[model samples]
Target: MTFSSSYLFSLTTFIYMGAAALYLIHWIFRVKKVGFLATVVTVGGIVIQTVGIGLRWIESYQLGYGHAPLSNLYESLVFFSWVTIVVYLIIEWQVKQRVIGAFATPFASLSMAYASFSPNIEDKIQPLIPALKSNWLIAHVVTCFLGYASFAVACGLGIMYLIKNRFSGASEGIMGVIPDCKILDELIHQTIVFGFLWLTLGIITGAIWANDAWGTYWSWDPKETWSLITWFVYATALHARFVRGWAGRRIAYISIIGFASVMFTYFGVNFLLSGLHSYGAQ
Candidate 1:
């Protein structure tokens, strides 16, 4: 009768997987009911995952750490999955489309899967380090992951646009369920702009936190350096879209590229490089 954080998280992972599978089936078979069911499953996954995250936060307190569940790779991955679902659902609601779930929910599912099953990631709660003790921890992590989640949704939309365009006439079976390329393109641009703003806030808050913790706002650490790089990549994407009148495949390409940068800034820097933010690798 008792559900621990781990138990709920494990259950949520399977729920996301089911959502992803249902979305894919809906997309491939053009089943309207399946699409509706997919949305329901995704919503269910989000609710359960939200409760699981809350339980984990409480468990941390029980363990004497008393911190938000955003400390280590396992926790970050878990929160990242949650935020990605939230961002995707908002887009689905605005566009009145469920097809994007095929592309978007998989990102959430994979994130949760990795967090729950990865051998290298530890799900145990630990006390925050001196630097992470600041209140900015929540703001910085939340904003950064929100931005990351938005970019992830944009990337999914971009992929959807490309698929719809690529199989325009020949593969009606697959493309028929997808939205128009124009709509996908517009959504991609809108999501990119949203992500860019959040990423900017994330970087700003991180700098403030860094200054408070390390006496410098800009240390050019590996993580900080890569974060700046990732920012510029998206900035250039937006600049090209706005000034050059670039849209369609160009913007789609940039969305994919920008997400690659985001992945690097998030995972690569944490694992492959060393920096003040290396505590995140824990």
Candidate 2:
């Protein structure tokens, strides 16, 4: 990548960190201006990140190899964080709530920062390996990360729900900044539903890709297994909420557990286990 492009990526990381801090402070102090500033900084970071991705693509072509940045763990993680922030911003705009952004922004920023700065992670735009040289690569990776991002948002809402539920009868000032427990629970459920739909599509597309590349629809790879485990957790949450008439604290706790599985699917599988998706490790 060009020096300028790397610089832009660095700047984007810093901006996101600032935005995340602003969001957290807003939640703690209930400052409207801090939330507004967080939104502004986040948008700025996204714009810079877009430019960085574009520059990396051009750099790949200049190196006589043309491929999307998604070919590597670092690039994929950066893109994952970018998509997470974008989706969180959209949800915040629609819901007119900033509390979730408090948690989401920090996590997103930290992930991006890790990708950008970690020496163990490779940031070069290398040619795609033969195993990954397929059209389905983009679809599979993008869809899965989108689902992961949505779940990350849901996880943030779930955390908020727990906090609000715990302080429902308390007179804490910070607790007052959170929404009602019922509203928090509803928001968590809605975000999880959104995540579940995307995750289903991601897994289906990945299955098709595996079939095309390896002539098998399922191999129970570590990544695939963890993803299935995550799906089951969320599915159980849905069943509990709808069939068992569970809501509020129980549902919030389930979402927390489900999102923990989501984290394992995204990070734990790569770092702690062996798999075909080891390219996702960083």
Candidate 3:
């Protein structure tokens, strides 16, 4: 079979699935070896997916589009998967915890699965809309999705936090694999801070792109509005952490809510609302 981008992405989806399972097994049955294998599988999957993305970019130029492979919903979803794993691996490296993969890899897997299987999403490389022809396209999309991917990992950490927090008393069995609640809390804050900076940059770059494309920096389009809302969500969480000394479940809840806003801004605004950015859905 031809090694098309779609085929590689499909393979990546299953690789992530297997990685997630290995992580779960590691967490549940205390299979230390499986945790290492899971990390290895995830690393291999991302390498293959990276090659696929580069191949797609080459294919685009070959087809005369001559643009980055980040032009539509399918491409964005694939990049989202890529960036999420990148961020997760970083966290794993820093914190020395592989159990988070059980929660994190699923997000990447689901994204790849959705991109590969969703009938509504087209995987073809199409011409850029005139508005998207700006050089800012790469900067804006990369920053925004980096922020999105970071939040995706943060959301997974939040879920892990909640699980460990809820089962504080049952710390002997499967729950033992998760880090301490305090560790998870601190990681949640650090992840959000990292993502917030990127999101802030994303919004700034987006506003500049808007000015170039639409003669205004802020149009309050549905996508733009929701992006601001998502920014504020993380901002509020950070503010609470810094000024109010909040932590634990409150921060975890906010992380989950913030990611919800991210999703709505990404998928909901594209599909549900008509706006200048509606071409994103295409």
Candidate 4:
């Protein structure tokens, strides 16, 4: 890693950690000033991370790799963390809610932390392999991570929902800042819909990339199979909502379940099973 990118990324970790503290404190105490500071720091950290990613891309070129930073596990984790914040910031702006950050930003921080610290992971930026050297790499990885980020947000909100629901009627102080069940349900549904679409696009892009690399459109690789299973799980959730009017807690549970499938598709397949995309394994 270049000096600039490495330093910036390290700074991003602490900035997010502090932001998480500020956000959680604000949510608990309703401190306007602290929440404002949290917002500033979160946005600032995101900007810094963006610069870090850009620097990494430049560094890749300097090393003659000449590829986007989305070429490996470390880069993808960083990208995923970045996208999660981007998605959360947008939702916080649109809904004008800050408390969700209490549940959201820690995931971003931990993703960075893990990428930085995990002994099992490799952070070096090597040249793209033959299979990954295509326009489809960017499209496939970006779209998929967007979907993953959205689902991550949905998972966080699902936890918030259950908490808010558990003490909603009886204990106002514990879950006071949490929005009502209706709003939480709607937000979860909206995120799921957004994620499902992006996952669909990611799958399509992956198919295109696969055919380009391997001369086949749909081989049932383990990762591919798990992704398809995830797609079906969300599809079933959506269908239940549209046709059977499933909503509220059921939908929230489904969102959590779908994210489990997503995690498996992302980390589990790469770690436990060998496949065509074995390069992803640490």
TM-score of each: 0.97, 0.95, 0.97, 0.96
Alpha carbon lDDT of residue 278, candidate 1? 85
Instruction: Give the count of colliding residue pairs in each prediction.
Output: 0, 0, 0, 0
Q: Please state every model's RMSD to the true fold in angstroms.
A: 1.3, 1.7, 1.1, 1.4
Candidate whose TM-score is highest: 3
Candidate 3 per-residue lDDT, tens place, 1-282, comes to: 479888898999999889999988998988889999999999999999999999999889888988998889999999999999999999999989999999899999999999988898988889987888989999999999989989998999999999998999887898887899999989889999899988988999999999998899998889889999999899888888765557678899999999999999999998889888877897
C-alpha RMSD in Å of predicted model 2 compared with the true structure: 1.7
lDDT for each residue of candidate 4 in 123-200, tens digit (9 for 90 to 100): 877988787889989999999999999999998998899888878785556487788889998999899999999999
CA lDDT, every model vs. true structure:
0.90, 0.84, 0.91, 0.90
Better of 2 and 4 by lDDT: 4
Q: Which regions in candidate 4 have their CA more than 4 angstroms from the true location?
A: 243-245
User: Is 2 or 3 the stronger prediction by TM-score?
Assistant: 3
Predicted candidate 2 versus true structure: per-residue lDDT over 161-250, tens digit per residue: 887777788656888878788778778788888888889988999999999999987999998999999999888877887665587778
Candidate 1 stretches with Cα past 4 Å from truth are 243-245
Show where candidate 2 strays beyond 4 Å: 1-3
- Candidate scoring better on TM-score of 3 and 4: 3
